[model samples]
Target: MRLRGVKGSRNIEDRRRSGGGRGRAAGGIGGVGLIVVLAIGLFTGVDVTSLLEGADAPQTQSGQVSAQDEQAAQFTSSVLATTEQVWTKIFNEQLDRQYNPPVLVLYSGVTQSPCGGASGATGPFYCPADKKAYLDTSFFTTMSRQLGASGDFAAAYVIAHEVAHHVQNELGILPKVDQARRASSQNEANALTVRLELMADCLSGVWARNVQGLLERGDLEEALNAARMIGDDHLQRQAGRVPNPHTFTHGTSAQRARWFDTGYETGNVGRCDTFAAARL
Candidate 1:
């Protein structure tokens, strides 16, 4: 992605140097399991409080911010501004409504959200309770180093996906889905969650479509690879477990990529109705 002249978002809440430090080591989730959870929570609006409960209390102080961290912050802010512009126009033209953008919270290791305590291990998530997306930019390092999903566009996809969740909230889809999930069986709830997540992936593609001028060659593949890498099936295999359909909260790798492609090709929000589709 070429973001040289893009304006940074003013709705950012930077807490990277706010004295908060990384939480204790993953207690029971273990390193690999933590990564799996992180993959699942990436770009997801689902509250992962229970999965993150094992982390010990956050430390009171943090190290000095490095130049690299500052650069990441600026990049994140630029991507967010693009999303704000894209979605605002999308809402006005497509939905005939005003788009209220969500605040993106940039934290380092750990931060407090209305939903719960968050750490780097929690990955990036949007808390519907607060209507804010929380991100520890270090996850971009984790994605490249461990998950093999690197590239500026891949990172932009992450931000767009979280913002997509906020879009779902703005459309009044989340609360109704949450209510249905509560009344569903475990398997059914997981299925619903998958639809919710896949829709976000597709919506992220919609954002990408609107920002075509900034994208470069191979950028789309970077995002698709990132989507494939974080699929529940892919993450399960990474964790040395057999892929189980019943346990999937996010759609399969193929489903994610296809849905994203759908939105990107059509640039139509109506085409992203994962819930109404008989086949994923």
Candidate 2:
């Protein structure tokens, strides 16, 4: 967690200063549908692109960035840069392929995105259509206060998980999964989505393994706690709903923490392959 003097990434687009205009839901959907999409996206990392198709977003006016905003932006850029360094080496040595890093868009409230209009309500998401990771810094506050997932390492885990999705996109796993989701039943598609998200959790642990030097005491615990808090089962119970395995999009708390530990213990990309495993 020692990030002082670390070089921040220039690939970021800071939109926190802008006033993101409020608009109706995509495809003219009602508030209920938008809430469902946003709620699912908050923890599950599901692609809401289809739900946001043909949506129009209002223009935003540029404003000023406060000092606190600047700090968060710098921290985010640093985490992203670390991911670029680690993943680039991983792709070359492990897969013999080039790694293309995705842009991390720092927005507040709401912002325009190729996948759709992004807002803090949806949490952080990776939009494959635009190859960008959209994040709202306020989510960090929510993570600490509401979810009890505190610490910089927990925030970094969130960013790394989104970047891991970009890794899956580069591996062509996302498109294939999307196609399969289109052809399968809702429950079947949700199952695939769960696997995809758990794989990202594993990949984040792989990232943690590669960046051991950057980690310190209690860092791994922060990330593991974050993973546990954000699990579908945990979130469902928090919302006062019964935890239904059949409706689960992301895995259970145990599944998430276990997969992350699997990658961290093995420290091998091959070991992080969730698809090949009969049990996840």
Best-fitting candidate, scored by TM-score: 1
TM-score of each candidate? 0.88, 0.87
Number of the top lDDT candidate:
1
lDDT of candidate 2 at residue 103, scale 0 to 100: 93
Give a tens-digit lDDT track for model 2, residues 162-254: 898889889998888877877999889778878888888899999999889988999999999998988888877776668877777778888
RMSD values for the candidates in order, in angstroms, are 5.5, 5.9
Q: What shift in Å separates residue 218 of candidate 1 from its native position after superposition?
A: 0.8
Off by over 4 Å in 1: 25-63
Stretches of model 2 off by over 4 angstroms after superposition: 21-62
Deviation (Å) of 156 in candidate 1 = 0.3
Pairs of colliding residues, candidate 2: none
* Residue-level error in angstroms, candidate 2, position 271: 1.4
**Local lDDT at 1 for model 2:** 87
The residue-by-residue lDDT of candidate 1 on 146-247, one tens digit each, is 677899999999999989989998999888888887799978987888998889999999999999999999999999999898887776666666878888
